[model samples]
Target: MTQTAKQAGHILIVDDNTDILIAAKLLLKKYYQKVHTTDNPFDIEEIVKTQPIDVILLDMNFSQDAISGKEGFYWLKKVVEQDPSIAVLLMTAYGDIQLAVDAIKAGAADFVAKPWQNDQLLGAVAAAYAHAQDKQKVGQLTRQTQGLNQALNQGAGGKNFDFLGQSAAMQQVFSTIEKAALTDANILITGESGTGKELAAHAIHQASLRRENALISLDMGAIADNLFESELFGHKKGAFTDAKADKVGRFELANEGSLFLDELGNLPLSQQTTLLAALQNRQVTPVGGNKAIDVNIRLICATNDNLQQAVDEGRFRQDLLYRINTIEIRLPPLRERSEDIPLLVNYYLEHFCHKYKRTLSVSDTDLQTLSAYAWPGNVRELAHAIERAVILSEGELLDISTVVGQVTTTAQPSQADSAQSESDQLVNADTFNLEELEHRTVRAALKHYQGNVSQAAKALGLTRGAMYRRLEKYDL
Candidate 1:
């Protein structure tokens, strides 16, 4: 019998025996807000279709013509088909225990036997209702999680980047960013090209106090050298031949927000003086104008060049470097964290599958090839390769042919080696001896591989036994 109360639920009881239905309805009236019963199994369908049935108590056996429990099974499937989330409790006699268990396997929430105790019946109904509610909640949460994942995937163009790794180099980068986000000082991000310096800038900005405001960005290298002053500090009407109206500079636009200056090393020496003045004074005087505009903006600058060397050569201002380098964040190239490549690949594969409305899976061989190659362009280049593969995919699974074209288009050995030599000179300047630099390189490689002798040896172009002897000699 269903229990009656101010907040009691509506219940529907289905059985073929009139006496049993009347008795059940009488007992349920004391606990339920509404108790509807039907003696004919056929009438149960119409009652459910037209009424608000919160719980359905179904009899395992109906009339004699309904043998083998076929009718009962049909109605159970129908009810679930109509509302998969609705709770259904099966009713069976002691002799039909097997049928009750079968009904549960077929999706019944629970079961109660005939001639049951009043307390037991009420308990079963309560449990079934709770289970149904839990199922609904989980379903809603699953949909919401999927929606968020889809939105992020679409925003990233179906590519996922792994910003977390276990290497010591990555750990240092993570710690620096975390510490830097807590302060208001200007940050100077230094790293080789394609080493995710911009990503670090974004991460710091997103984690800072002024995260709500827009992060304005300007690539100093992309702008023309002659127009650098006007672009950074704005210009008044007729300030130059092309200047027709007054315009706000990046500093003014980024007020109360963050301004990310990329390729800062490329800015001419004259422009660096102006940038230094702006930072020291917290104000800017537009070209062809006398009034200075005050701004409260955080500065995050990135460069792949050695600014210290530029200062020594009289190409960059020492004063400007001191102002912008209050805090420094350095990022290692992708080759240093190659173990994270497989994780990033799987994430991107799932993302692309959902984005392109295609079901494609990646193979182990594909992952091996990607991890083996040197990513000179780093994560950005890897993302393009995956996108190209997805576009060329023709079946449910990605084939090797889909990636051949992209691999061929990447930087060749001769070009990459030349670039590496130039990059090393630019990054290191002339601060250290060759032998000392070699020791540091070997140590960094060993640390990156977690002291793995074979891996570090391969990375440093040395035999395993030779690397072990050097490690002992250097006491690394």
Candidate 2:
């Protein structure tokens, strides 16, 4: 392996003896990429902040009659205070092992005695660098916690982030969210379109350890295949023709936060590999930059498509799927939780009524009609229906037909006469399961359209994606 790939870390050695600093720099340079020497401890904080130094080697006794290591302890305290993530390693004589131990207890990560073995010094430095990496992650998390507290306390749009559902299925989903929020694990939210997958993802982020950070959401479906990398990992100035300046990618912007990957199944196969690599490495190099900056983010991905089926079809990478699907929360569609329809209707009714400055309410009889119908578009459609109804309502009692017309008029097949005829035929014919009737309807639509997916999807009142998924489920 190349030196750059084989070894990593920036080492800084600070000591009173210039020779010791030079010697330590020479020894550690072979094992690490960057090494710098300094004879002054007063500039320790400046050096640490100015440079991305992973480990620092410090001397216990600086000036004459400093054998007690008082100055060293003071410097160590300063270094630790400046950035505890930078592992501080003390260098002392064999007789000062006691002082070194005291320094270690005071926050120094490790210590190496003078006249150390080549192997011993290298091992200590390597271990210290490892510790620095872990501490860096902890530091990020700590900052995120502080920021989250501020946001929640300040009421930063927390009220608008409405997540309401109390059915058994929804309760289970909420339970999963609570359990998974505090950890660094990746989450995959699966549901049909309009089932509030994105809302659930936001809820998890709000509840997570990374909640203080902004939840950076990327709609993989909306992003073009060619611009995928530049969108996620970013590019440096002049990296490409349109590259204007150094732009921070979503990953960087979401540092110490949560990253929500919406419509994750729509991401192309090629970008899937790149995404998997970044998640595995926990680092990214800009398009024109060589140094990989470490990132700490909680990943929450949502998809309406079946990722496992996509993997089987070679449309998605199985490894990438596995990485993001550490904790899968499958959200049930609105049809399964019919009990929540009245509650949802009232909630949206009040929200839209307040916004539109209209006093409106849905009658129980009209709500029953809404609850009885199958909401193919789920809660999102229900919300729209209420909003449109509230806007159109001329009286306090909502016009139920006006509210129901949105879905029925926009999605139903144009052949209204034939649909009515078929409904009458079904009513007069033998009893049939609703699921079977739905399957037959979809299959008949496809046949009528001569297997044209676009026409079939339109006629069947489904998005191409949802129709395509149902087709696979029924092997049609």
Candidate 3:
């Protein structure tokens, strides 16, 4: 039978017998690229320290006079202390089988009899090598999983929300959430559209003491002015035109839990007055009902618009804002925290790759371009981009060109102009031809650097040679 040599593995064999060492070396040489042999148990530590050893095959009886396996036991403990990941296999004569089994309990991976068969020895070695490799892989995966979970736990809680950031801005937000979690006060989350305000509200709910209960969410924008009172407070049967049966509102459902009121700034004046009354009284009076119901609930409100500005315009109630803003958490725009782009991109890339079962890797250059682009839609937009890229990816690595192609057509021209312009210009479809505009922008970058290729290349996130070739193709 032909034996397949295990590639790129190092094995250490420690035995007191010179004949056994020679025989084992000859047999193991075919399986491993590097094999180190030591006849003295004391030299095992030195060999491990100087060499990259994956597995240690130690003999149970190291000394002729000492048959109690004391030397092997002592060395086994030392080897494990030095590197916990190293796999160890113990060997003993047929009479000393009990001693070999005891060594296994002391951390040895497996045991082999002294009169070992070739297949048995080879199988043990192969299994030990595989086990060690698996340990290393699991360790790496554990670290990555912990990192992602910690990041998610630190962000605002909500359904299917992704915590996307590694920037100082995000760090500050995380620290604020950690501090806010210690209190039981009402929280107000403020941010621009698509800034994950709802997510932050969810985070507060998850981190709060009342997390066991449900987190009921109500979109103030989605509730009609006529249905506002019934939505905030439950209604008895025959309350309105659509009322066929008694219904429970968000306030009642979120009793002892968190009530997330999204787009709070959009709530009509009439609803705000009723909401303020409910907050101050710690109770609710259902529409078309005379009885008052007492409830204990934590209120968390989120909004993209400025409530203070709305209050000035007499559109939003100031008293309601004060009640909700007892503690406020503001999420900065993705452009303000550009450092988090790559981390968020990788997070979404991994998520989508797994979702699609695709093997895809992002190149450093592709990541740079993604980081430079201003994500108007924030983390949500970036996730969509990565998902699209994963779907379009043809090979082992994601093709940036394919991503760019999809992005160029759907991407608003104003967004690209806003990214390139010195001022904050809103990008709309009326701005420019995206393909021609992208080509022109690249040409402008090349001209600005005076053909000082590297500088121009850096501005456009392209290699110097690649930029020069593109310039030639465009006839610039």
Root-mean-square deviation of every model = 25.5, 12.1, 27.6
Candidate 3 steric clashes: 6
Clash list (residue pairs), candidate 1 = 2-28, 3-31, 3-32, 4-30, 4-31, 4-32
> What digit string (tens of lDDT, one per residue) describes model 1 on residues 58-97?
8877766344666667778988976566689887664376
Better TM-score candidate (1, 3): 3
Instruction: Quote the lDDT for 446 in model 1.
Output: 49
lDDT score for residue 253 of model 3: 70
For candidate 3, the 10 contiguous residues with the lowest summed lDDT are: 421-430
**Candidate 2 structure, TM-score to reference:** 0.60
Spell out the clash pairs found in candidate 2: 148-212
For 1-476, candidate 2 gives per-residue lDDT tens digits of 12334257888888888778777878778878899788878787777656778888888787854567777778889888766678988887745667767888999998788888878888888889899999867755664455445435655332363788989999999999999988988999988766788888889988987776688777776666777877777666667888986555667667878888887877777788899999999998667544466888999998877789788989889899889988999998787888899888998888888898999877887888788766655776688778778888787888868756422322233334434544565556565888777765775565444334545686778876787677656545
Best of the two (1, 2) by TM-score: 2
TM-score of each: 0.52, 0.60, 0.53
Error of 1 at 102 (Å): 92
